[model samples]
Target chain A: AQTVTQSQPEMSVQEAETVTLSCTYDTSESDYYLFWYKQPPSRQMILVIRQEAYKQQNATENRFSVNFQKAAKSFSLKISDSQLGDAAMYFCAYRRGGGGSNYKLTFGKGTLLTVNP
Target chain B: DTAVSQTPKYLVTQMGNDKSIKCEQNLGHDTMYWYKQDSKKFLKIMFSYNNKELIINETVPNRFSPKSPDKAHLNLHINSLELGDSAVYFCASSQGDRVRGTQYFGPGTRLLVL
Candidate 1:
């Protein structure tokens, strides 16, 4: 079974600054997908960004980017130019490549991020 | 238009009561799933259905049952609910393609079993 771990329980960052949320996973499969989901106080799960294990280049979406290190089994999310809207609970998820049950996502506990003005 | 939606955003019921939460997706996706977020904020997959067929059934309790009348709708029925069942339930759907199919989630149903 694959497991994702977010060591930081809580994190805070000043407005316009950058914040990095650490994530590490355990997977024996060579090909997989890693994702970052943001859950605001509204409790809506929104996709922040995603990274494919086969790709060496990190994935970036606007101000959100990921540091995907397949060798270290680490996939961290970096939020640049952080804004108040960035305050939320961030989760790291892992999904094996392929169809059927392999598509099921294995999620981490979560990291609550606070953006300070 | 809402891609995915869930009814009864807030559900407050007593223990031993039965409740049902409905989920629908207008995205024409062939796959739907049910996930449970515990009080500790841990989310886990409970059930998954594809094309009205049960595909993945996690280690969830038998008290919880998932019904998919069609590919666009997946409803969860919980019988004899317990306090431990109090948590936020999320309904999500994704394209059935073999590639990077991202799952889109609903607003979530907050269930409180008192």
Candidate 2:
């Protein structure tokens, strides 16, 4: 069994600033995947970025990048030049890399990010 | 075009009633899943199907049935609904269960059981 934890229940960032959401997970498997998902008022889940456990280099997409620390089991999402549109609920998820029961995606209780413009 | 879509974006039903939610993906992905989001915004897995074969069936109750007509579609049918069954259901698809591949999500269907 694997569990993901998001320490921040709520976070606020000023417009044009930077914000980082923290996430950690517990898994015995060596191979896995970490992800950040965003849900806006429309209730649509959008992929922010994904990081492979084997890849030490963090994943970056536009304003979103992650500090993936395999040892500490920490995967934090950083949003730079934050805008009002970035206000949403963010979730950290984990999944097994190999085939079998680990194929399913597990999510953490979301962190509410409020971007004040 | 929406890559993954779910029908009946909003569902309102009475207790003990039976209802079904349909999901379809045009991404040509071979794997699909059904996830439930509670009032607290906690997303949990309900079921998953790969290539039309049942794979991950969480601790979901027997009343909640998932049917996959083909590889591209997975439908969720719930029987004897309770107020606790009220939540937002999301449909997602992935090329495969590979680590590098990402799962695309659909606009969730909000179910309100009264």
Candidate 3:
């Protein structure tokens, strides 16, 4: 079974600054996918960024990026130019890349981020 | 338009009661899923349906049942609910393919069992 761990339960960042959220996972599969999802107070889960385990280069989307280290089994999310809207609970999820159980997602406990003005 | 939607945004019921939550997707995707977020914020998959067929069924209790009348809809029915079952249920959809497809989630339905 694959397990995702988010060590930090709470994090805070000043407005217009950068913040990094750490995540680590244990998986025996060589092919897999890592994702970061954001949930605001409104309770909507939104995808922030995704990284493929095979890709050496990190994934970047707008102000959100991921530092994917396959060897270390670490995938961290970085938010640049953080704004008040970035304040939310972030979840790190892992999914199998192939086979029958690919539809399932394993999620972490989550990290609550507070963006201060 | 909302890609995915779940009915009854909030549900409150007494113990041993029966209830159902409906989920529908307008994204035209072939796969739909049900996930439960516990009080401690741990999210886990309960069931998955692909093209109206049961694909993945986790180690959930028999009191919880999932029905998929069509590819675009998946409904969860709970019988004899317990306080331990109180959690947020999320509905999601994605394209059924060999590779990992991005999933679109619906605003969760908060269930409270008193």
Candidate 4:
């Protein structure tokens, strides 16, 4: 079974500053996908960004980006110019490619990120 | 418009009761899923239905059943609910084309088993 590991239980960053959330996973397949989801106080799971293993260049979305190291099987999320509204429970997820993979995702334990004003 | 929606946003029922949570998607997505978030905030896929057909059934207990009436709706029914069943249930939809199709999530239904 694939497993995502988020070693940090909590993280804090100053407003307008930058913060990085660590995530690693174990998978036997070389081709797959990685994602970062943010669950704010509203409790809605929002997709922050996604990285494809085949792509060497990292994925960036506005102020959000990811450093995906396929060899190390590590995918980390970087939040630049962080805002108070960015505070939420961030989760790292993995999805197997091909054969539909049941359309299921294996999620990490989650890291609570707090942005201080 | 909300891409994904789930009904019975909050459910509070006693043990031994049977209840159902309804999920619908307006995104024209072919794949729908049911996920449970435990007290520790662990989210795991319980079931997945693609085009009204069961595609993935995880290690979830038999007391839980998922029924898809059509491509737009997937409902979760829990029989003989136990206190351990209390948690937030989220409904999600995706294209499932194996081309980096993203999964969109609903607001989620908070279920409380008393």
lDDT of 2 by residue, B1-114 (tens): 989999999999999999999999999988899999999999998888888988889989999999999998999999999999999999998877575358889999999998
Quick one: best DockQ, which candidate? 4
Q: How does chain B score by TM in each prediction? A: 0.97, 0.97, 0.97, 0.97
Q: Interface RMSD of the predictions, in order shown?
A: 1.7, 1.8, 1.7, 1.3
iRMSD computed for candidate 3 = 1.7
CA deviation > 4 Å runs, candidate 2: none
Clashing pairs in 4: none
TM per candidate: 0.98, 0.98, 0.97, 0.98
Model 2 accuracy (lDDT, Cα): 0.93
lDDT (C-alpha) at residue A56 in model 4: 96
Candidate 3: RMSD over Cα atoms? 1.0
Query: Residue A30 deviation, candidate 3, in Å?
Result: 1.2
lDDT of 3 by residue, B3-103 (tens): 99999999999999999999999989999999999988888999999988888889899999999999999999999999999999999998877464778
**DockQ list for all candidates:** 0.68, 0.71, 0.71, 0.78
Structure candidate 1, residue pairs in collision: none
Looking at model 1, give its docking quality level.
medium
For model 3, state the Cα shift of residue B65 in Å: 0.5
Question: What is the Cα-based TM-score of model 1?
Answer: 0.98
lDDT of 4 by residue, B6-74 (tens): 998999999999999999999999999999999999999999998898999988999999999999999
* Deviation from native of the Cα of residue A19 in model 1, angstroms: 0.7
Q: What fraction of the reference interface contacts is present in each model, in order? A: 0.60, 0.77, 0.72, 0.79
Give lDDT: candidate 3, residue B16. 99
